[model samples]
Target: MSRRPGRVRRAASAALLSLLLVAGCDTGGAEDAGGGQPAASGAAEVPGEIVLASGRDVTGRGGIRQQLITEWNRQQEAKGVAYRARLVELPGSADQQRSQLLGALQSGSAEYDVVNLDVTWVPEFAAAGLVQPLPDRLVDEDVIKSVAETARWGGKLYAAPFNSDVGLLFYRRDYLTSAGVTRPDLGKDAGWPVVQQLIGVLDAARNRLPAAYAKGWTSQLDASYEGLTVNGVEAFASAADGFSLTDKEGRYAGSVAELQAGLDELRNRTQAAYTLPDAVHSDEADTLTDFAAGRTAFLRHWPYAYRTLHQSLSAEQLGVAPLPGKAVLGGQNLAVARGSQRTAAALQLVAFLTGKESERCLLDAGFAATRVSAYEDGALTCTTAKPAGQAAASPTGERTDRMPRDGNGRPAYARGTLLPALENAVQRPRTPLYGAFSQTFAGQLARLQGGTPPSDAQLAADLDRQLKRALPSH
Candidate 1:
């Protein structure tokens, strides 16, 4: 799947199709290098090319991640260093990519010096000694507090927070105005009650609404994977004060009463009257399409959707705010492989890629930045990627920038809404057995979405029992 010249690839709202994993074939014309192996004990370190294996960049072809790497390579060349970095995007879903990385690292099959790992995978990889601990300075005060917590295991730094993500509420401002509402800004303080009330107004004005309008809101609630787990976690956290299902050691610490409370919130939010019926079967792609087609007034989505949606929706038609309650923290972290022979250069690459200027570049390209300065410091701008004011050029040579921006060229919502959301976001369970935990948790929550859902108490007891078995118990 080589990219055509001069063609600008926009983010597609479809599931990632399976593709053959080609090493160094279309990576900016880099040569194919053999897999890296562990050097013998006390072996002299050498400067050479380091491979960074990651999942596909959602930012489209030659995305910001690649541009950052290319910039790093250029710096090394100017300094007369022999080290260069190559990015290898593994082909498949996140789960498949995790498995592939695990196999490649454990069996020494791939010569990866660094890996872009999901936040949840930090504990597992660190515990397994698959990745090396990084310097504390790499994650400092400038990094978002809640986000920086994802890079550590047992109080040691295992990875560096790259770009980050949090759930946000995207609403159709036109729909609100159509409902005769004066103020459409559902500010940072807007809660679930406000959302439900606004939904009632939209419902009352359905006669004047678009034909596609059918429900108040939509979200990715598909029961097959992480969608259900994330939405469930948000519900649980919102229901109970300081709710945490597991302890720091990743053991089952939740009681039946707590589970019951969480289940009640989940049920209330997904009631048939408020949520789109298709949400039960919807993933990220489905929910995005439904919102864009005017089927719903409100949407729960990630930051990248801000750019994707703006491509089709004007600023006057769209408005974004913080999620009603808690948002599940998400994004990848950069970790050095334990077997890498270029550990020194690998660390340098990680530092450069996650630095302040680079993070600004990521935010400008539609990724949620991990640093606060990228949002608040209007003086700082992305110097590595495209120029701030340059319009996006399409394959047809048409140039336009539809996404709205602030005075600093950051996304319009970055400082006021997005940064605060990241500061207060909650993480999924951090444990060596997160894989097992997600499967067990999502499987039990699916009962709430069934035709005849079980009572909250019944589901709570069932979830508690299953979670106790899936993870270690106190």
Candidate 2:
């Protein structure tokens, strides 16, 4: 393991970080507070205004969360409940939100009651005691099994899934049809191999697709950022526990060779013109926006893009499928602030936010649900297609997953696509030093994506060295 500096490349990413790496990582928007004093939790019940802080304000009209909070507030007001809940909006950048929350929590401030955290930050917050672990009653199996799993670390439930996300391949059905190409089933097959085949097919058919579709495929491949790290994990490292990049006991389970191989494959694919030329500079929004503008036949992004693109594309034109690789999981989770005086009330709000009805409402608002029932009752998924060379299928059967629809009642994107994608989301490395690892990994990946990427062995060796720096020794 060998190469580079210790300066951490921090940025204010957050729900923009699903806004991608907020698939949706870009530069972060806020500052970091790493040296805040540890705060103690208030076990007693002090009721009053409980503040729920999140990176994004998914409240208000069309915000399923807002509706639930409104109802809760009404009940509280009517009953004169000691504590009533309200929302405290934060910066849109996921990373910035993290910085602010860290600053407050480390400073021993009780400014917040319920903390809506990014799934990736659970470990850091939990270790710092910035948030308290949840009772088993809060995070149950009823939440989407995989999503709920993100809330736990060392077998403790530190957060509750509020809304969850996974990456998917968004392709144009019309373009594929024009090319006489049958869309590939990305889910049924594993991530990287499926992507390889998809790229090959798209490359071969690029000439046949419409001129409006300027690119064969597009993704958040910009180097020097978290987006590339996500792509790398999605490709070669999603096998066991996603981007954890290590085994349950916290040892490197993925090899530099494996990651390098995938990077080389991507380099070849992009060089072959299957990926957009601008991809090296693109992030999630750039990729989605280009695809939505009909510039590309396919895109890889978080499901968060569906609502943003709904106005531009029809359901029929947009085809959703599993990503060739599993998606890096994105979304927010609920935790009670450690220093809050309204512990009991905050816990209640956390339950309500992560509860069944709330899940359904969130799903309908275009946020991916963290509960299986939300997808089932809300109709968010369809059975995926059989693997490549197998029979194509539809979201048929007597299933009851709720369909994601727009205000106009049109399907937001499609089923099977997002649902399967969410199920296959890979978690990132769960260390508190995620920013350091991400920064290092991103730099090496950027170097590889360059015209003269280092030899595989050299690149792999460099990666190993950097990760050893960012990660604790086994």
lDDT of 2 at 360: 52
lDDT (tens digit, per residue) of candidate 1 on 259-351: 999999988888888999878777776778778878899999999888778767899999999999999999999999999988877888888
> What's the TM for model 1?
0.91
List candidate 2 segments past 4 Å from native: 1-44, 57-62, 182-211, 238-244, 249-254, 265-272, 378-415
**For residues 23-44, what per-residue lDDT tens digits would candidate 2 score against the true structure?**
1111111111111111234554
Candidate 1 ranges with C-alpha deviation above 4 Å: 1-42
Candidate lDDT (C-alpha), each: 0.84, 0.63
Write down the worst ten-residue block by lDDT for model 2.
22-31
Per-residue error (Å), model 2, residue 191? 6.7
Which 10-residue span in candidate 1 carries the lowest summed lDDT? 17-26
